[model samples]
Target: MKPIKNVCVVGLGTLGTQIAIQAAAYGYNVDAYDPKPDAFATMQTKVKAAMQMTRKGPTFPMALWDAHAAKVRLHSSLAAALLTADLVVEVVPEDVESKRKVFAELDRLAPIDALLATNSSSIPISRIESVTTRPEKCLNIHFYQPAVGMNMADIMGGSKTSPETLQAARVFVRSLGCVPLMVQKETLGFCFNSIWRAVKRQSLYMWDGGFVDFRDIDRAWMTFTGMTYGPFFLMDLVGLDIIYAIENIYFESSQDPRDAPPASLKQKIARGELGVKAGIGFYKYPDPECTREGFLLGA
Candidate 1:
């Protein structure tokens, strides 16, 4: 209802931290919360890395990075973070019950008029809105990782979500200089996510089915698309564990065997091969071959 001057970001993981930084970079007062105190310690370092990476993409007002970074306020408690927030963005794990629990808590703790949103990749907002009394103000404001490079987000509403809420969300997304892809009705994976999901599914199948070597597939894809990363490299960036979880969600919803995550991914998880964070996944991190310059040109 009120101008969204203050934003509360719950969860300080990869995407969560970036959202908070991006909001702050745009001069919004950001209150970031995470249950783990240790996460708070790394905020500065992570923010620096994200800024460095985003600079490689689009041209922006680079001077604002420092001024905006100063606007972020960290807290360990949800109530403290939501105290002055006009909107709250939840970026927790993609588990249904976990999201419901966070939504319930947010509804109870945040200001009555503060709109609640989730950054979930696949789970629809309606499934989360049922746990709160303010369903009309709850929606999905899904953001792509490395929020700076992909300056677009999926904005979807639950069945009971109000039109006013949706417009307010659009306004909020625009405030961060990000485009909002509106979904008129509830949908899994929103827009780009649905397309990406298909690519991820096919990529996993190709690797697991022994149809082609992963590196060759990536090489051919880069040569064709002239992109920096292929499906496997993107998977590594998105995190293998997260990919597995997203696949499981699709499988559970459709009960289609084809949607089930590949057994190889599960094995990777068992061995703690998360992704760049663990320094190993589809490719070694910090210096993944696909990320090298001239990769698409056969470097």
Candidate 2:
């Protein structure tokens, strides 16, 4: 509430690292933490890359670098990170049980008034809130991948999330140069994932029915909608395993058949064909050439 001088990012994965770097760039003293010590090095590398990227833009603010180096600190211990945190954002993997464990620990370790937020893509804020004693301060601050590039964010409130807490989160997110849309009620997939699942269902149906190949599907969206990447490409960028996990959670939470990830995806996941990160998915990416394999069906 007091302008969030010091913040803690609880998980230093891809999303968490981006969020922490962005916050630091905004002049907030940041304490970044992960259970793994190797994560510290990974996060630092990411921050350096992000800083270089920002420097290339004409509109980039130079003040961010000075504040970032002076204000941000990385830690491997949860206690060390949460000790002086005024706001704590949890970006752990999208497992409800895992989130519950993190939230329980945060509630115990962080200050009582610290604004606790989750960056979950699909998991409900209500479920996360249930694990914490101070549910009134628990909320969701969903940021898209590459948080520095994406300006849109969602501020989702659980049943127990207080108005004051929501307002604080909105202000904080805005300070990071992001647009925050407040979701009045908490839902299983929130806004983005729900809409994404619907789109994915249709795409998977086409793929499974042999109606279209991956290239055609991607081209259709890019050509017509003017999107930077098509569904398949975006899925690959997001990591096939992560996409599968979200769909599985959506199916479990809503019991909706449409939310179920198709057999093709399950089979690929089972075979360890996890997309760009894993070097294979809808399309193959050879090491030297990076050539695409699938052809456009209707082109």
Candidate 3:
């Protein structure tokens, strides 16, 4: 098996920075690329905020994040980023067309032998691999925010993804001190994310239908799960804009009206209430209601 030494992450948005930092912390040469000039800096702030909110997610000290992060070389162009990459993780917008464009660029620029993967939360790699020449080398290697201590990766192979490519990705994920949750077959929102998606969907429906206040739902979740946050809180961390987009993908796929994301959720996005990144969403950030005393105790 060819060991992966260099990791390149495309689109340093919500998940990219954490992924990059984790790879670098584990001794991999990491590079990141994002079209937005200030994307990396913005992501850094979000990560720091996440690190503060989390205790068990981050594997290293907050002080060490900068050192590990500094190890990543940021590039202005995709070609430069993929030049030395052995594995490329694409974290672009979760739309199929948007992903197609990125995979095409990645296929054209990345070294022929390098493996290409997408960190898309819901869409599977099968919808993307056709855009690349090396379909066998393409797979879905999804990650949650590892920088905050969720150190598991969802690993799934596309229709044509080779056994070798899938095996190599498993090795790479393990090297980062992560549990690689293998998907035996193609599935949207693979593994834990699929479970998370179900929670998000039901939560949004209830809120939109006026069945219950979002906070009450969150309180119940935290109360039962013993987690620091609930479904709505986690969605904010994922970004409301991203949540809306992923929901749309589900609606478009199933053509089920019931599967549609709530209209109010779209309004929130339209108003720029894009969760933690925007400082507001289901709750205000850095000091959301979920964190207040007596929130879970129903005060």
Best by TM-score: 3
What residue runs in model 1 are displaced by over 4 Å at the alpha carbon? 40-67, 297-299
* Residue lDDT tens for model 3, 1-299: 45689889999988898899899999999988999978988889887886665434577666788888889899999999999888999998888899999999999999988899999988899998998999999999988888877888999999999999999989888888889999999877888888888999999999999999999999899889888888898888889999998988888889999989999999999999999889898888788878878888877
Candidate 1, residues 156-184: lDDT per residue as tens digits? 99989999999999998887888888998
Clash count, candidate 3: 3
Output the better candidate (1/2) by lDDT.
Answer: 1
At residue 69, candidate 1 shows an lDDT of 54
* lDDT (10s digit) by residue, model 2, range 85-142: 8999999988889999999999999988788999988887888788788988999898
Q: Candidate 2: where are CA atoms >4 Å away?
A: 43-71, 285-299
> Which residue pairs in model 3 clash with each other?
57-148, 57-149, 58-149
Assess candidate 1 and give its lDDT.
0.82
lDDT against the true structure, per candidate, is: 0.82, 0.75, 0.88
| Top candidate, metric lDDT | 3
Give candidate 1's TM-score.
0.92
TM-score of 2: 0.85
